[model samples]
Target: MRGLNDKVTLITGAAGGIGRSLVRRFLEEGARVVALDLDAAGLADLETQCAGHAGLLRTMPLDITDHAAVQKTVQAVHAEFGRVDVLVNNAGWDVAKPFVETTPELWDKLIAINLKGPLSLQHAVVPLMLAGEGGKIVNIASDAGRVGSSGESVYAACKGGIIAFSKTLAREAARGNVRVNVVCPGPTDTALLRSFTGDGEFGQKIYDGLKRAIPLKRLGQPEDIPGAVAFLASDDADFITGQVISVSGGLTMHG
Candidate 1:
């Protein structure tokens, strides 16, 4: 949480469950936030929610999957905010279904949101970070990436790609003092998770099974994530890079 005051932070997926939580947390930490999301209405509501925060909030309507659009936004953000201090790649989408049962169209959407969007953002932001002399990039991947998840083969692949990409980028960006790392969430109760689990008995069964499987006897909450994310984005994590931290309530662990 240290050294975050007045920092220029950009977060994608700014309207969703975890994304909104991250925005609120960063603002509370006194960071100037550039909240980006495709949901303009949600961004407006988020701005209202951020009324009394010490830091400033600027919302932008953006589709992360659009490469040229991402570049333009990054440039515009830099022009307005002066420089970006941190970038949180949190926008992602997917549906739960067996790989064979899933269609290529779904695969395209999965790759575009989960993989390509972050890739494009990184491509645009890293240079600005290099020019600014330093920055932090905290990618929100998934435990599915670390330890595969059923009904999420393509999504897991995209997340796994993110894990690999972050480490490589961290190593390459170290000379510029630009740190990169990943946070992999477990079975969090979010809108996306609701979509993953169908209604009634099916959803309950999956949710209960996850609780029983996890070392902790409950599903993860959206609020449980931002602390780790903020830590990674703050100066407290100056020495930590190329690492993947799992926020999965002990459901996933690495030595």
Candidate 2:
């Protein structure tokens, strides 16, 4: 919450769901935001939405699956902002299905978006953070990754990989003053979730089941996420690194 004014933040998956909330929160906290997403149209829409926010908003059309492009974009962001004070790896995609029902194609897409995407961004950004004294990285993983989910085998795996990767990077980046951490959301209400559950009777059934299962007796909202991310990205978390915080409303209590 502190030391965030005018800080430059680059957020991936900035056009949807939790990504959208993260962008809004950062800007509201008086931090400049560079929003990156595959949906150029959505990015443009977001810019309009944040028309008069306390801080500025700049949108870039990005596909995190491409390493070289991501690297190049990172360079451009640094060139434009002079520095990236925070990097939130929030871009991800997944399809709900059992592991046995999943295919290689699905696996590739899942890995590309959820896991490799963050890795590529990190590869490019961490060095720049080191050169600039330090920066913060908050990766959005999922509760599925932390404790597994019924219909998200591959998605869970990718998120699990993200959690592991964050810890390892946190260890490697600490000396360089770059802090890495992860925020895992439990069955949150997002477009992705809707797509996963569908907009039909079955979807409603699935949604109800999840809500009943969570200890808080409800699904999470987009707004529920950004506070944790904002904390990690701000000086408030300067002493924190390699930690995984789950905003699942008591869904998975892992000690």
Residues 151-181, candidate 1: write the lDDT tens digits: 9999999999999999999999999999999
Model 2 ranges off by over 4 Å: none
Count of steric clashes across candidates, in order: 0, 0
- Cα distance off (Å), candidate 2, residue 234: 1.1
Model 1 lDDT at residue 228: 98
User: How close to the true structure is residue 145 of candidate 2, measured as C-alpha lDDT?
Assistant: 90
lDDT of model 2, residue 1? 87
Worst 10 residues of 2 by lDDT: 47-56
- Across 1-255, the per-residue lDDT of candidate 2 in tens digits comes to 898899989999999988889999998999999999999999988988888872488899999999999999999999988998899999988887878998998899999999999999999998899998799999999988989888899889899999999999999999999999999999899988999899889989998998998999999999999999999988989999999999998998986
Candidate 1, RMSD to the unseen true structure:
1.0
Runs with alpha carbons beyond 4 Å of true place in candidate 1: none
